[model samples]
Target: MGNEHLIGYARVSTQGQNLEQQRERMLALGCTRIFEEKISGAKRDRPELLRLLDHLREGDVVAVIRLDRLARSTSDLLQIAELLRAKGAGLRSEAEPWADTTSPAGRLILTVFAGIADFERSLISERTSSGRSAAKARGVKFGPKPVLTPSQIAHASVLVNWSRTLN
Candidate 1:
């Protein structure tokens, strides 16, 4: 698109890591603006990433050095891609050309990836449910520890009854 912007996002996992290389690469790739942050890809709350997402506009392309720099997992990548698609923006990875969302073939690949991620999630949910059911059958107790023991509860009941009798 004529009015589209090539916005860049560069991130590192820690304060000690340098963002200069990613910044320079993105700039060389013709990025109009770049958002840089030092945060782990595994972290859910990344301020600069959030800001970049919020900064996206229709026809904008988020250029990143690599897919791993953008997300830690496939599901996370899909979620971010979905957000970009919803916002009418695109995603491009310099390292992984197949990851570009602006092309038809790339979109198809992403669609297949999304389906696989969905199936994986479903399998995980089913396994968890089965495991929980089996654990319950085996008398495994789940959830928080009770605040009061049976004896404490009985004592409180007796005290309440005594107060009621007094009334």
Candidate 2:
């Protein structure tokens, strides 16, 4: 393989967040092509991310400012890493400094981190579900309130029912 090109991926969750710092860092690292996204990591589908993945080829190196920038959840990160591995590509994180899946030690560290991320996600889900259940027991309503007031909704319902009967 020829000299591998450093492919940088940068993301920010909000418009207010600056991509300049990330761009500067990636440029400093000799990244010729950088993919940037301004979307929440919670979102599973991101256009730029997909594009970057598609553009990656064997012997390419995917660089990110941080693991969190690549993926918010552990499983997602692992999945991305696996994709890179399958493509004969590798992952590097600037912030972590030690996260380089190209090396044995980096792989070990990533595994440990993936486990921790999974645990954290599980705990968050459990807590959210418990909180919702507790609120329900107290007769708290979930989701959006009726768009119209109760009286207006009842009127609308009656009108619809009457119209259906007429039909």
- Candidate 1: the clashing residue pairs are none
lDDT of 1 by residue, 64-157 (tens): 9999999989999999999999999999999999998999989999999999999999999999999999999999999999999999999999
Top TM-score hit: 1
What do the candidate models score in CA lDDT, each in turn?
0.94, 0.90
Q: State residue 134's C-alpha deviation in candidate 1, in Å.
A: 1.1
**TM-score, each model?**
0.92, 0.66
lDDT by residue for model 2 (133-165), tens: 999999999899778998998999999999999
Clashing pairs in 2: none
| Residue 52's lDDT in candidate 1 | 97
